[model samples]
Target: MSAALRIGMDIGGSKTAAVALDDAGTVVAATELGTVRGDDGVVDTAESAIVALATQTGVAPSGFASVGIGIPGQVDRGLGVVRNAYNIGVARLPLAQRLSARTGLAVSLDNDVTAAAIGAAHLMRLSGTVAYLNLGTGLSAGFVVDGVPLRGAHGVAGEIGHLAVDPRERPCPCGQRGCLETVASGSALRTYWPAGGDHPGRVLLSAIAAGDAEARAAYDALVAGAASCVRLLVLALDPHTVVIGGGLRLLGAPLVDGIRGELDLAAATSPFLTELELSARVQVLPADSSAAAVGAALAGNL
Candidate 1:
């Protein structure tokens, strides 16, 4: 039972990942599992992940120093409560308290995007300001300034997705029109290319290759929206790096290249944007990297 070991869990809409970090902050053991929906199901799923990591590391769950969780939704870190996480069917839950009571360890919670931002800075060994743009089920940005996450006064700092930038004014679930999210996210893809089905990013490239006009249009909009986010982050935060993360990042190099290309195109006219070097600062989160989970663990220590 190593008291130095710490646990971090990232509970996503469809998947859950857990990792155990050694005293030196290196990941020693990790596991992934399907996330179960609803309050009890989420708790059970988290407990199962803890058990799996504990077994792998030959340490009891209670032996860990603390449990940190990165979850989607409005997280009340002070209260250890999460609400409005509709993707996982968690309307409201005292996640940290529940998990702590179950595991007999301290627990902390962070917004999933903020956690990823912190993890990206740590893993990439980046210093100075870093802005993490999450292009996933929804669009959002997270910031880490000199290794400290900027969660803002009310925890709504990086919610640029709802800015309503589109002239057409598409409706958003947040009750807004023309939100950047409505044009950029996975949900946006589903709406734009309904024939592509639930997970559009997976099949989008192939569809583009097959000459599907609709798919091409949707992909183009996604690229444009993402580029807009990068530009917005730079103009606002002037971050040293802007790391693109989240599920759509699975689209890989093509997606990154498209974003850079868009930025370059925009910079072509605006010397202001050119000097900022927006495209050069962009980087993609590595595939299969447990950034959110790792960040969760780090957040616990902070």
Candidate 2:
């Protein structure tokens, strides 16, 4: 029999990325396209992207055993629907069913961060408990235990972005005050440095390098929120490793160092925190890795 081909797609607010992997999970093809809003537009865009990828790679979509998708929103995997994905402007959309009908392939759908964790774990060959903290346009986490993602009862187990780390009443889109995303995510940094241009993260980094006080403060807030996230995860799941991914990972050493410093400071205050060794357990994935797409594809196998 031909090796099973698994297709994975990561649907983001601005762009959509898709990849095809062989039975062994090696990427055989990949492509990207601009994301579209609305149910029909989104489905059409994904279908076109997948078809284009298959054509580019000289493989037919029907040849693939199944398709897996990672989307930025609350996904009801059991129902094969996206309950809400504000960034992509989707709500109550039957994403998996629509894609399956269009592509003639079985479909598996999951939250982007959750799929990313699966991909990261597969790529890193990580066993035991692992946490994937995504610091992207927004912030959230995905936990994988023994190769399976913990979806929780409501499938929101890792929605740590809205955990309300700050009490100063900073408004969040989720109708909350002081959500971690309000201070720590790419969106938060952009709000802090609104004039930072298109790539706010890079702009903020440059400003920090130039000793810009406001920029520094924003960065510090990000560090504190991120550190709190790790602390909470350590105390709750106590995962073997906390792998940091997403757009914010682009901040590179500065971001990692800041998080480490904050964790270290907290560790010094309490031996119990010190025992967690969060700094040592944290790992950063390369910014360019297609973890979400790869993981989405792997989701089909699961």
Best by lDDT: 1
Clash number for every model? 0, 0
Compared with the true structure, all predictions reach lDDT values of: 0.92, 0.87
Off by over 4 Å in 1: none
Clashing residue pairs in candidate 2 (N, C-alpha, C atoms within 3 angstroms): none
TM-scores for all predictions:
0.98, 0.96
**How accurate locally is residue 115 in candidate 2, as Cα lDDT from 0 to 100?**
93
Local distance difference test, candidate 2: 0.87
lDDT of 1 at 74: 94
Please, what are the lDDT tens digits per residue for candidate 2 over residues 135-231? 9889999989999888789879888889886976699999999998898898888888776665788778888788888888888888999999988
What lDDT would candidate 1 get against the real structure? 0.92
Quick one: how many clashes does candidate 2 have?
A: 0
Clashing pairs in 1: none
